[model samples]
Target: MFFEILKNLRKKFKRLYITMFKNYIIFVFLMLLVLSGTIGFMIFSIGKMVSSEDYIKDTQKFFMASKIVKSDYKKIDASKIVASKGWVEILNSNKKVIYVIGTKKDKVTSYTENELLNFMDLSYNNLKSGTSYFYSVTAFNSNGEDLYCIVKVPPGIVTLNVDIAPSPDKYIKKAAIYILVGIFIIIVFLTVSVFLYAYLTTKKVVMPLKKILQGIKRMTEEDYSTRINFNAENKFGEIRDAFNFMAEKIEASIFERNRMENLKQQLLSDISHDLKTPLTSIMGYSKALNDGVVENDKKIKQYLNIIYNKSKRTVSLIENLHEFTKLDNSKFLISKEECDFCEFVREIVSEYYNEFEEKNFELEINLPEDEIIYEFDKVEMERAISNIISNILKYNEVGTKAKIELTYDNSKIQLIIADDGVGIDESLKENIFEPFVRGDKSRYTKGGTGLGLSIANKIVQKHGGTLTLEKCKKYKTVFRLKL
Candidate 1:
């Protein structure tokens, strides 16, 4: 048990209950060791005091002195008696001391019958003389006469006071039973103490565990907000922190999942509405032409052109939806290469320069002379930039000032496209880059699929860059692309 308890102490475990239990075991073991040592010491002391060799040898010496005094008192040596730190007195039947041997300190030479009996009694006390001695008396026959021989030993030499009885077996048996009962009571008391300590110590650990379990049960019931508070120490404190952190992460994950689900539903609804409007126009125009509803040749040509335009718009919407879906795919990879960003912007702007002139819109172009080379997919990057430029032309008035500026430093390149056009609605600014989110309320008349900004944002993200609609003091709408 000692080895097992010590071994557990040597290891470092994260569990609180195990550690507490080990400590309790160690405490009980130590208490038992101490109790056992105390009991053993008490038994050893009692046995040594009761039946020691010194006590037995002293009794034998007194018996030998009695025999020698009865047979031949002169042969009993006084030197031997004095050396043993005691004296001998030979008393006649009249209770009078007839002979004395060794160094005697007492002056009493005669004793009354009552005094003699008192001296021989087990509870003998020499209070009047202010000195105490142990007396052993032996009655024997000398020359056919009765004589009492008393051996007096000082208290410092040997002290034994035992009651004379016919049989001492019953007393011994009673003493043994009392000792056994005392030991049993002590063992029971110590056992109860150990268990109480174990329960109290383990209770501290169990309470915290119960609290954590309750939190887990609540979470399993879809209560993501459930949390636990444990104002404990060591492993329990750490467990509390870990559990709370896990709960926060789970709650956040659930919230994000719900948000993405809502966005998916909104995207589906917008797709359906945009597709149905263009298809309805195409179907109606074709039906009118096939049924000969228009008689004039000019009207027939106009109706055919309208049907053709509506079909083209429907096809464009489908193609934009396809591009958005492809870009949103997690497995999609962009082919990146080193390209001159300054020249790339200039070329894209030159393509739209004629359109700007035809629309009578003011244009501002700012491009650095030195080449700013960056890694990006040229085709994808062109599509993203063209989407922003096309949106500016589609929404702004004829006299709206359009600006394209490219700037760079040693670390990064920034391209800014700004226009003083009808600014985006405040309500839509936050979600402007979400799919199917449009600035124009009239979906049919806007001539846009509303996936332009979202696709552009995704493309820039794929190239490890950012495209953000930032606040600007000079322009109403500013799109900043950083690489």
Candidate 2:
């Protein structure tokens, strides 16, 4: 029943507060239980010790009672003797009773001298056979008379009859006071110890929790600079580390998001700039022809050619934008199959043969005589190769050496395109594959959209291949493709 109440208290106290409070309550309760048990066990042990001894220690009290009856009964109150719960009997030297006090007259009061010698022994045996009692007999020294008496003392408070004086009441009261004081001292010491332990333990917990709460508050205010600086090897330490990691990730994500937003604004400006140049030229040329500004067949033909070219540039820009958008979408799908890569590039270069001749640019092709088969999306790969070739035509000087080389081993394939024209600007090399990035800043410098390299790189990557620019051994610039 006691344990059940303690268990209920533990549950109630636990729900009352935080973990630190729970520890404090449990520690105090345990200390109190230990103190109670210690005091209870000690008091019980003292009682057992006092009871284990025989009643022979009461002999001194009985001797004092015999003295009172022998010489001082007339001076002492009979009620006081009865209050001591003992009766007195005096016998003459002949062993006959002279007087009896505080008890009825009995047969053992008178005896022969020999009988008196054995009287106490027989009386004790009889008393043992009935109920337990304590008695004493001694020669009383009073008035120079030889007298003997027996005092039968009952079991209330027996006054000690020891020589040199004894005070039973004083000792008992002092012992009881000392026991109470000792218990109080122990309780005070235990209370102090319990509170000290609770204070130290709760401080350990609250200090770390305070630091963590401060960090979280900073994080809530969008301040990710501060860190939780806990070094303990415990669960709180794990919480601190995890919190730091989350804050770091959130900071990085915000930085990246801002960067992308700036890039998006820049892309819009570039697109508008590119489209406006062609549209302006087309509008001006058409207006001239409509207004009869070209008066002859030759001027009219030249104006028509200019208008057609401007229209074509505008169409190319829109197409490139659409293609890039599609490729950037993660859901965009491409069809793949095994095809002859060398033949595929050969066909693409053949389509550009007329343009190469018109521009007076040289075309060099290198391939193994046998067909080199590879898995790829045929239409996408052809578009990528055409974009590479188109970039060479648009950027390279006329009559520059333009070479296409295909090399393969057991595991992979490499395709190289080189041109002996002005290489990419050193400043733009790092971001050459970025969307709408071109060597020449002016949209009219080269009559093409700048998305060629960017779109080509994306297509090659989608086919589990990479496209990168590298230093050429025999050419001004080279673009290498590895699959």
Give the C-alpha miss distance for residue 97 in model 2, angstroms.
Answer: 68
lDDT of 2: 0.73
RMSD of every candidate to native, in Å, equals: 13.8, 14.9
**TM-score against truth, every candidate:** 0.58, 0.52
Clashes of each: 0, 0
lDDT (Cα, tens digit) per residue for candidate 1, span 1-483: 323422432342345557777887898798878688768765775566447654444334442344345456656655645776888888888878998887777988887887767666644433233347666666776787788777776666543333211244554664576578658867887888778876765665777778877987897788989989967776667767767777798899989899889999998998898888878988898889899898899998998898888788889889888999999999999898998989999999999999999889889999999998888899999999999999999988888988999999877889899988888988999899999888767534869889999999999999889999876777999999988
Task: Give the poorly placed runs of model 2, Cα more than 4 Å off.
Answer: 1-216, 224-248, 350-373, 399-403, 407-410, 472-476
Q: Rate the local accuracy (lDDT) of all candidates.
A: 0.78, 0.73
Residue 60 lDDT (model 2): 32
